[model samples]
Target: MFFRQHRYSNLIIPISYFLDLLIINAFASLLPIQFQTPVLFHAYISFGWIVISLKNEFYKIYRYTKVAYILRLIFTQFVFFFLILYAFIGFFKQPMISRLALAQYFVFVFIAVFTIKFLNYISLMRYREKIKGNIRNVVVIGENKKTNQLISVFKDRTDFGFNFMKQFSAKSLDFQKEECFKYIIENKIDEIYCSISELQNDELTQFINFADNNLKTLKFIPDNKKIFSKKLKFEYYDYIPVLSLRDIPLHNPINAFLKRAFDIIFSLIIILGLLTWLTPIIAILIALESKGPVFFRQNRNGIDNREFYCYKFRSMAPNNDADQAQATKNDMRVTRLGKVLRRTSIDELPQFYNVFFGTMSVVGPRPHMVKHTNEYSDKVDKYMVRHFVKPGITGLAQVRGYRGEIESDTDILNRIKFDIFYIENWSMFLDVKIIFQTILNAFKGEAKAY
Candidate 1:
């Protein structure tokens, strides 16, 4: 009776994703360069494309969009889509993806997708009418603040096509459930917004049954207290219901896998290409400057409160307070070589092995000392949330001048804030951005790095 229903419309994007690929390959066949698939290509595109789409939220639609909006989404989605595509090709060591063909494919795809958007927009416009054809009459059956807010929203958002009907106070027992249902029928009400807290269980059940039996929609209006946090979402299993805070993005499986995949590849490149020759020279420098071992190892808290021996070049000489105290500026324990290592950020490079071993990541919350982890989790808000993702060699906090020794509670608080933000809103693009910024900051040298 309203605008449209999209029960099967979810298939449009998935089908179009592959259709664009086929059109690209068709035109690419005309060129001298050929696109060939590797053994992993089947495993990747078969299930991975759908998983990537799900991660990128390319399918879910809560409302219709203008053609411009759809075009923007298409461009952004394809950028990420191809980012993962190229990542897979490089990670699996597959045959070369044809650059010319890939470019031509998108050119054609943009044109085709552009046309498709206008068609969808036109179809939606054709379906929507000004009066009863595309509008729904809804009423509020409660007198609470939340109910008022709901009514106000419906009244104001004319684009939603909600025609605000009369509201009745649930306090007035004069309006019984039967009478309310009768009123809804008389008014041709399309939805009933009821405050569950205001109604008796039996009365609520009666409204529910009536709404179902009458083919009218019923939406529960929850009091603000029940919501607690804006991040909470509801899910159902069989008949049981559950409310959960939305999982941080890095904690999601597809996202975690992508981060780990990049970690392994990036770590291997440094370990094999750079470390192969650079390690022994740094080892000699450490041996000459210090009396103890070439590497310093200490336990640090990792993902899920687990502790692991994080590695670093032995910057500070052997000290009894190594694990308990943080390094201070002009500390005697720091050797000349150690000062250079700390200043240049080379001391943190050994953690690349942690990344390769799956214990850490290349970009994340910098691992805290076990003592600091225990101390700050109590003092800071949402500090433990940082541990939700693997600790990193460098992170958003480090590049943003929140790195190094904590001089005040404000320092740790700000650092934890950035760490939590990175965990909650992570993306491979963000990781890359953080990595580049970190490299730039390293060259500039951090004053409080010690």
Candidate 2:
């Protein structure tokens, strides 16, 4: 569900940064440390502090982040910052910079920073809990055990700042989408939550699209299947897991920028370091064995359901079904070399170009053939949700053994589940893990690789 904007919330990080530097410099001045140029030392410390904080995500605190996590971040940031401080002293050869004074300065800075940070955190919590500031008005669209638990949370946790407005049953004959929209508009609801089990795919899509169009937050109460994945953000209301539909980490601008930067650097490394030499060899082999072009390009559905020409090293003889059919185990269409390339996953390497060009990501939901996208959009519930992020050359599903031929309904379903998980829970760490797993799978061999 949507969060109401706190006027000062946006300023919290910048203000914290400012106060932290202020404390560092102020403590330095008070401590008995001789400096050649006080202004230059201040500048060095300030720049070093900013760099360390950015690297460590020191101020990336969230409402749901625990006090322990915040404390851990503070500890980590200071340890690195402490090193930076000493490096400056050592580099400048400031013999007059007293070691005892530096230690004293650190203790003072730590206490001051710690006190101010917690003071702000505790103050905000108290304000939200006691005064009900920064409140968000939310409504539930279906009745179920999870929804009831969530309603209880809204009622019990005043500090969360959720104002429970009303609950409407999706199963009731009186229920209408238009009526719910009208109520939301009249009541000025900030968030809408639906019970995924109660609503049809069409109804779910309608609510999702409506939320996007109206600029309201939409969340879901997952059914009692215990389908919680590591990637999806589950905000625990007491014991109930409430799933956020659009709370993807990559949706954050800073996160998006970081992922994009990583994609570029990684793709460049692969393209320049490996593909420059490997491509010609593969291309010659494919040409010698096949009548068609060395590279295969087929239309695939990507982010936002847009079609793009996905590239692959041709592993099969030229065929009309290239765009429509998936390669199956021991398929006659596959050339002898194709089997090795497919099994090794070398055939998929060319999509690094797609990652570099921005049509795809290094780790995301694998794009399906355009025809399959249309067929599955109608057959599979929440299938289109995977298109919310760019398609990937290798993905969680691939590493989890759900790649290649969609032999059964369960196959596609499981793949989409993992894909959704990747989209929801994406981190640089997760991406790297998936890539490593992909590499291991390639070397170890996969049953469905063909």
For every candidate in turn, the CA RMSD to the true structure comes to: 16.3, 9.5
Evaluate all candidate structures by whole-model CA lDDT and list the values in order: 0.71, 0.84
Where does candidate 1 have its weakest 10-residue lDDT segment? 1-10
**Tens-digit per-residue lDDT, 1-450, candidate 2:** 223431335456667777898899888787778888888899999999989988999877755457888899999999998898888888888888888888888888889999999998888778778887777899998987778888988888777778899999999998999989999978889889889888887888889767754546788888754443434566655566678867867655456667878999999999999999999999899888878898899999886677899999999999988888898878999999999999899999999999999899999999999999889877877787787678888899999989999999999999988988898789999999999999999899999989
Candidate 2, residue 263: Cα displacement in angstroms equals 1.2
How well does candidate 1 score on lDDT at residue 119? 65
Please name the candidate that would achieve the greatest lDDT relative to the true structure: 2
- Model 1 residue runs over 4 Å out of place are 1-231, 239-241
**Global CA lDDT computed for model 1:** 0.71
lDDT per residue, candidate 1, 1-450, as tens digits?
323221133344544556645544444455443446433454554465466557666544322234455566677767775676566657766566766655665566457655665565454445433343356688888887767776766665454456788888889858676677788989888767777668776776667556644546566665434533355544321222223333467644446666777999999999999888888999999988778888889999887667999999899989899999988889888888889889989998899999999778999999999999888776765677676678999998988898888999989988988987887789999999999988887788888877
Number of the top-ranking candidate, with TM-score as the measure:
2
Q: Which portions of model 2 miss their true places by more than 4 Å?
A: 1-175, 178-246
The estimated TM-scores of all candidates read: 0.55, 0.58
